[model samples]
Target: MKEIQHRSDCPIAFSLDYLGDKWVLLILRDLIFTSKSSYGDFLNSNEKIATNILADRLKLLEANGFIKSSVSPEKKNKFIYNLTEKGIDLIPVIVELMIWGSKYDSYDVKDVVKKLGKDKEGTIRQLREKLSARINSDVPSNE
Candidate 1:
């Protein structure tokens, strides 16, 4: 991994250095909430991110330890992207954003918002557990 220069000592600044861009967050959102994993899947996202920018952001995310990529078994030339523990840790942030967006932007996330409103911590825990299982499932056990 290449060394990243910090703009400031603040935690928010450090996090923003990696996640300040809309595209990066959107990509992370897709990884967490959608079944989209391949480059093509991401290209088909509603945001319609440009190929060049998508490629760049994917590379950055992998380099920064937020995501990892593995060659597809069915198509060796293609890669499947997955979230790392670091990326999975951002789930709460994304959920909060969803709740806020539902309230202000009037997004159609009412079902999720309602669940979160009833049990925010439990919802987040379930999400993390599911995601953690997915991530762990992708790895081979040493046993």
Candidate 2:
């Protein structure tokens, strides 16, 4: 397989290259919670991403192997996209964002925020465990 080049050696910088934009993470947040797919579904998200930007980000995400797209068997013209394990590994980032935003932004995630604040490492460990368990179940044990 061909190697993929990261923008920088720093872990944060490299991660930013993958999910730096606001729209990318917003889209990911939707995917994680709603399992939404297709152009129309994305356009209808709470953040209201523009059609063109969503298209571009989805393409970039696919190229980077964060997601995979397949045709909808139910509809000839529809498409569906699903997260890869690499993408689902972002739960910690989302959880951290939840904590930070809950602090400074005063969002309504108090319950989760309280949980994270109470035990940050424990929260991360549990989140990672859940993600891993989902991966183990969703994907075959030996793939």
Candidate 3:
């Protein structure tokens, strides 16, 4: 079967072309807000992303320069995935979604509120620094 194509010229459509899936955004949300960086953490999410789907998203996200994965210091068998500069730049998107969720999705997220309260811009700035500092750019590290 042929894959369906999105023909809209809007940038949102373009973005969605790569990351429009429901699971991708949530995974991103968790990474940014929860500082989650490992496989087990993502697997343990309340969203309960399926293992095969999670693996697929991780590979795609990495290919698109959205995230990078590295060996965990505490667990050699596990990988700790970190968002790249491109990924960190998604803070505003996450902020907007969280706000939308609180307003419409009916979840009480004190974490997001607190994050925004304590210097929203500064928080995003710091997040950017953290993500950019360790970008792997799909380049194989000399491990």
TM-score of every candidate: 0.88, 0.72, 0.80
lDDT of 3 by residue, 1-143 (tens): 12326769888888887767898898898888786777778899999999988888887777777888877666678887888777887878888777667666666667756677678787777766766665634534423
- How well does candidate 3 score on lDDT at residue 5? 68
Top candidate on lDDT is 1
**Candidate 2's residue-wise lDDT over 1-143, tens digit each?**
22346877898888887787898898777666554767788999878888889988888887787776766667767667766788777877887786677778855666657877889788767756654554454332211
lDDT value for candidate 1? 0.85
Candidate 3 Cα outliers beyond 4 Å, as residue runs: 1-8, 133-143
**Off by more than 4 A, model 2:** 1-7, 110-143
Q: Model 3 — TM-score against the truth?
A: 0.80
Q: Model 1: runs farther than 4 Å from truth? A: 1-4, 138-143
Q: Worst lDDT window (10 residues) for model 3? A: 134-143
- Lowest lDDT block of 10, candidate 1: 134-143
Model 1 error, position 128 (Å): 1.1
* Count of clashes in candidate 1: 0
lDDT score of residue 57 within candidate 3: 84
- Which pairs of residues clash in candidate 2, taking residues 3 or more apart in a chain or in different chains? none
TM-score of 1: 0.88
User: For candidate 3, what is the lDDT?
Assistant: 0.75
